[model samples]
Target: MSTVAVPELAVVSSPWSLGPLHLSNRVVMGSMHTGLEVQDDGGAGMAAFYRERAAGGAACIITGGIAVSDEARGGPDFAVFGVGGADERFRAAVDAVHDEGSTILAQLFHAGRYALAAGMVDRHGAPQRVVAPSALPWAAARGVVPTELTAAEVERTIEDFAAAARSARDTGFDGVEIMASEGYLINQFQSPLTNLRDDEWGGSPERRRRFTVAVVEAVRAAVPDLAVTIRLSGADLMPGSSTDDEVDALVHDLLPLGLDGISVGIGWHESRTPTVQAAVPHGAWLAYASRIARVVRASDHPEVRVIASNRMTDLRDGEAVLADGLLDAVALARPFLADPAIVDRSLAGSFDLVNTCIGCNQACLDRSIIGAPVSCLVNPRAAREVAFPARPTTDPKRVDVVGGGPAGLAAAVDAARRGHHVTLWEASDRLGGQFDLAALVPGKEDYAATVRAARAELADRGATVHLGHPATVADLAGSDAVVVATGVVPRAVDVPGADLPHVLSYEQALRDGVPAGTVAIIGGGGIGVDTAAFLTESPDEARRATEFGARWDVDVAETVVGDVPQRLPAAHRTLRPGPDVTVLRRSGKFGQGVGITSRWVALGRLRDAGVRMVGGVQEYLRIEPGVLWIRDEHGDEVGVPADSVVVCAGQEPALPTGDEADGRPTDGLVTGLQAAGVPVAVVGGARDARSVDAVRATSEALEAVRRLAP
Candidate 1:
């Protein structure tokens, strides 16, 4: 076996050195929801998940927040550390981490008032009162209120943190990170927005710091060898909450407690601060880290280390912060999800191949909300490192991959990594297919970057990336296997006047440009809605509409047959961010297809932007020049004026070759691969490819069996 050289990664020689215990590397994988704890084997899957990260070179891995007690747990799916007392299963979790040559840390946390009261009501078969520092409604979900915690209850909470730390040490963990950020229970006690207690745990800044300090002291006493990392909300960044000066004072006071390190994080649960956005530069929260670091560094106490987190993606930026003495180490969350071997890639100087997490917050947090395992849009093996470790193929057969979207790139890369000589053919000049257009959208540059990174990685890994080639059977001849990733195309509507010169498809516009003029978009799906929002000009409007550019009252066309199309569930829809735009409904009914939550937000944006509504229209035709003829509900045609007609209508799979074998749509590249008798797998948005991963794995497994046949 050849040793891979990784340079960019900060080597941690000891876990205790960083915190209470020495660490091996500076890379700390952030906590994420894996949904693996709920596996039938009782955290067996979860153990494997952590083991992979540890094997990948994480010195210390922090498991997703666990409930100190039952009431604090989000659900049965959440990993419980100390609930029902620490047991053998918990020890198994710790052993799993240690067995991989890395230390494990458990986050001690409580939801307090933020606990899901409704969820608890359903689970317990009765309603339960939500507890917090004060009787404040959960800001995100209104009408669900929490009762204030008493002074005694506050003391108990501190004890809970200490007990959790003891559990960590007992369970063989390196240490515990006190949950004091993101407006959790500890955060509620620290923030004035949630904590309105009049006693020693609330009301005054000194009192608020009391609970945090006590938790630190108790945990330190409980596990003197275990590193105790404090995740602090340096600046709540919320109105009427703890200010920067108060945070500074709090950290300074805690510095003498012999803490291991302080991971400075900003933003509270109810914060209006934009944590992830293009407007905010990378490593935007370095200032907050620097502030706390300054306090700890300047203090007489010498044990505590300062760790910088929050939007730290680039190595140069992280090094800059470390070089500037702002932080001792950098904690990366989403970036790790994108590439677990980020340290290796950085050390290899393959920054181009390192998937730059665009802060999309899509596969990471968004998927977590739906109870799906956290995943990465760019790196396919991110969370599946153990389940799908890179292995050499037994057959060493040739493989061909068609299309170059995320799924295709992943399949090709995996196949190549398995020691197969692979050919990746893209019909277009570039590798990324439909995703190429996605990169043009504002704030979506990450999508493009991910595509570029995948392409570069494939190239470096020795996959033949053949641009400007459409895969065909003749071209794929004799290939052991073929992987098809032919992506989806725009959905079209059969409405009249669809062929006008001004009527432009979203793909065409992205490939070309949406000329600066009046424009109307037909669909209100994510693409359509996003297109409509992007066409408008002006920053305020873009923010309001959440579109690409600043909001400008540009000439735009929006097709409404008086009714909105369905498929736009408010839960999944992204509302246009600005005004200076209009929506024309085909009928009087608005948001017929949009989801309730998304509809409210989108329609609210449209109404706020002064979008014009055109209803009860029929027989949309080209009437005169520069106008669309629309017949009313009564069959009366009227001319609606417009400068450009933009089509955001849906799409269908446009097969490059009309090859229907045996009276069926040929399974395309996937079919071709199987026919070629090569092992293959598919992934990503292509539903057909989901099953391919299993097939490829099984095929490789069978090949191994054959190779060993006597």
Candidate 2:
């Protein structure tokens, strides 16, 4: 594989100014919630997380949204800025970011109606009531209407914003940004669908803009010296939401009210649009920033810089957009999460080593939504910086790693970095066991980059890699310690006629192509859903277009639909139909264990591809030549006729089995080896059968190597 050469960045590394604040560069760390505040140090873990990014050369760091009022809190773990007893607690966070020579901005927010449904409690330990412009619930709130804020409550809310900004200024923060996007309280007041009041807060465009404008004015008045920015939704992207013109008009009205800068945030939580997912085209939201930049340049407040955000993965992309004068600076949230030194490395021209974010959102947004601490899928030390330390070994030893999958590769590289001689052996010709299959799934090509990076790191660290060489007990005879990461194998089902040629495991189907005909997949887990999508070739625009044309009887030759047939004359004729696929599972829900952030996109793609999904199966009776018999939820046996049946019933730990081995779980390998006077450890899927994702496997590998080094 050829390397993707990094282009020379032009304006991305240059210094920029946002009103009174002077940034060292154009790269800004956008605000993202990190559940690290659950620690006991009064947000010290969260502070350390931000400090790392600042020390790595991010020009400015905007802290995650901090609630101003007790009723505005999202949860107990969320940080609070101006609440009565939390002044010193937030000052420590600001001091940490400032110690790294980076300007820190506190993002003050109020969750509003979303807070009540989020189970947020007040200072007195009672469930907070949701408040908005009108008595409407967000789509995710399950029809629970919010209490309308009275006229006096609206006045008090504005005062709360003022107090938050004043508290930030007193706490030594350089600035404060009003969290006015992403379906939060301020955005609810600006959006037409959420703000349906007949009072001064809602009614027409001017009345709707009253709440935001008043908050800005009050915050600016409260902290005249501090930089006051507002994060606005460039496009709500929801039905009956604010339009581009309305956003433009709102920006026009807010600029005169002492706004220092504007950060463009795309989409809301309830938006049906694909905003930050991997499937979204790179720089797809740049045009929205450009539209706002055009509006900002036209207004009298030209000093208010426009920051472009969403799906910006590389500095070259930011440089290109910055050179085009569409945006003054670029904000990156996930990229910083993936690599804290992203800016410094790009500036030093070490692009190959920089770990770019794959936009998976698995560990970041998805985990945060479930009230878990945010961590990066590729970088295990993101949130747990203190817990996962990388220290050189005082006494180096020879290490043998028996696997070339993610866990083994990680172990080899970490051991080599820690002054140990390491050798990694793989039974297969290539690396990345199930990860390779995962990369082949639709909209997941970015996963291949991870494998490439691991391979490159191993080569650079001088770790010996032996492919197609299955390790035996003899290989570990001379080694001081051994790490086994043999990974997992698909569990076999005990249904009748399971040995039929028509039945294939998920790995088998991925290795050998799926048969062309009706297919029934057992187990609606992540693997099964991904396999169904793989067989259907979902989200492939050309395939979807062809299928659409075939279903609706539209002639592609005459009509120019979706700009495909007109551009490529042979697209219509070269289109091939995918196989008819159905997914069967014993559980009620499909795609279990899939992240909430990307689950809808995955399931929506399956639905669009005409895939049938039936869950709540009581039993699998049997699998015949071209038929699968299963008992449905109604206790009635049904025969599902298909050309092939694929089983993705989940994985089991692959333990050693031979005369020399006792066939025990891999965790016992360490104790057995220690009994024999050899220091050995187990990592990755071999360590456990559940929750063996890339993040856990890599972290376990690093920890295991650290333990064995000394």
Candidate 3:
């Protein structure tokens, strides 16, 4: 196993004080919706989830946004406190955090227009009516215009916040945080674009600040003993939203209301800005928090500590941000999801073992948004902490895992940890199969971390990994059980001229580089879209410099445009005019298999790279030497001229075959192995071609190994 150098210790591990509350470290587990609540017994899963993070070394844990009122409820599964008469349910959770030597804060919120769209229903079983400061709808909310909140309703809402805070204190929570960010109810009133009332709650900047100030005062007075923190959107990023001056004035007004600290959350859900996705650089939103911190530090209310959030996974980066005095502490949500023991691992100087978040929100935010129980893409046992605890096998045996892809590696690690004698075989020299190609995608280099972690884990757990060796039925004869995880084999599309020299597979193109000039790519799934991104110019350093130079009327010359190398391969060489790439999908849309959280950003990047996308192809006529013929959705024959045609027509399961099989290869490994008088299980793409992603592959492998016990 390769060792990674630990970053120098800094303020991340140092003790800090948030008013009267004393913390063990600067690491705070920011609020993330886990959807773990039982909706009856409060939440056994929720309590266990917090306990895991607390045990790992978070100084503070903020509960997922809990509804303060019936109208404010985010969804049926969301945690509720004051209005639901279920405050007692959270007592166990708070006590569990305290027992773990960490302070827990309840985040109270009202979703407002976001609420109705979230499918939150009232106790009467009727759909909750959407309400906002004005009769405006969030752009994403479709045509669901919210009812304007009356003055009496506004007063009641403020009272509900105070009641929630009081209930949080009563329930043994050490602190309470008001969720005024993320275009929630409070933020709806804060943003000028959403709040268009001429009344006291809107119009002037001061009036727009009224609701937040009143809530702070009410909550502070109601729960004087408990710490009070307010989460504010440093920038809404929406058109006509609150300016920096307005935010500064609002902070200035709220600072005098006995606030404990401020957590700066950036961007709104309605805004077309990239906030926490993979494409967004780490600490991209730190400047927003810095601005607020600067205002607070320079003000008479210097005691108000600022907490920065969004895309802060690495503790080293957090340390840098703290050392620069950008913010008092860093709040991480997704990192905790990826690895609950992030703080402990960083403190122990085992940086390599830390499962860093790849910023793929597939299992976390995407699932939560659809009212599903949230889990981590890499770490499957995130929310199921109690349910999925690793246990040793009662009856251990020798296990042979064929293939060293994500599925095979996962199985080897799990089997070895369970006291089984495990050996993993790979036909290739490396472990990661298609996952290596996935890492090569633009803005997706973080995926390599997962591959590295898996490799390190295989080594640490004593799993014998044999590279460049394919396991046969004879090799697994002595093993108690065999797991066939050979993954997938790319299938060729049944089209004329597919065998042309200019036409290449997506995998081949990635490995040997795309040919220069115009290229037509077939298929528009995740692979095709990612391949398009790989072929196009990355909108990073060079693009930025070019844009900057163009704007300033400066010749970029040597810096932006360099002399072309003459020794490069024809396939590896990029032409002077650059590549004109067009992606064709047989389906209606591109990036169909992409996670909802990052798909928009990925497509946006592809768009910015001048990649032409055409979907709903009626038929593919054929691929010629320098031109590809296809019928559009309207049955119009389009001759797309190209230097090369790259086929990303997807993959098929590479199940074991030959004399080891009962009949055909598609009969599957389980049937084949069983016929040969051997017990066998199949996982990942080998089990089902559609199950090609990391999330499914890892999960299926883990479950398969667990079932193999005894």
Supply every candidate's count of residue pairs whose N, Cα or C atoms clash at under 3 angstroms: 60, 0, 0
lDDT for model 2: 0.77
Q: Give the lDDT of residue 209 in candidate 2.
A: 89
Candidate 1 lDDT (Cα, whole model)? 0.62
The order of the candidates by TM-score, greatest first, is 3, 2, 1
Ten consecutive residues with minimal summed lDDT in candidate 2? Answer: 556-565
- Tell how far residue 278 is off in model 1, in angstroms: 6.2
Give the worst 10-residue stretch by lDDT in candidate 1: 555-564
Better of 2 and 3 by lDDT: 3
TM-score of each candidate structure, all chains considered together = 0.80, 0.87, 0.90
Tens digit of per-residue lDDT, candidate 3, span 543-614: 533543343232322211212122224456342222388889987568887888788877876776678888
269 in model 3: Cα distance from truth in Å? 0.8
Alpha-carbon lDDT, every model: 0.62, 0.77, 0.78
Please state the error at residue 555 of candidate 3 in Å.
24
Candidate 2 residue-wise lDDT, 14-84, digit = tens = 77787798887888899988866445667567777887888888889888788888777665667666454
The runs of at least 3 residues in candidate 2 whose Cα sits more than 4 Å from the true structure, single-residue gaps closed, are 1-7, 82-89, 116-121, 124-129, 139-145, 390-400, 410-422, 477-481, 500-502, 538-579, 618-626, 629-641, 659-672, 690-696
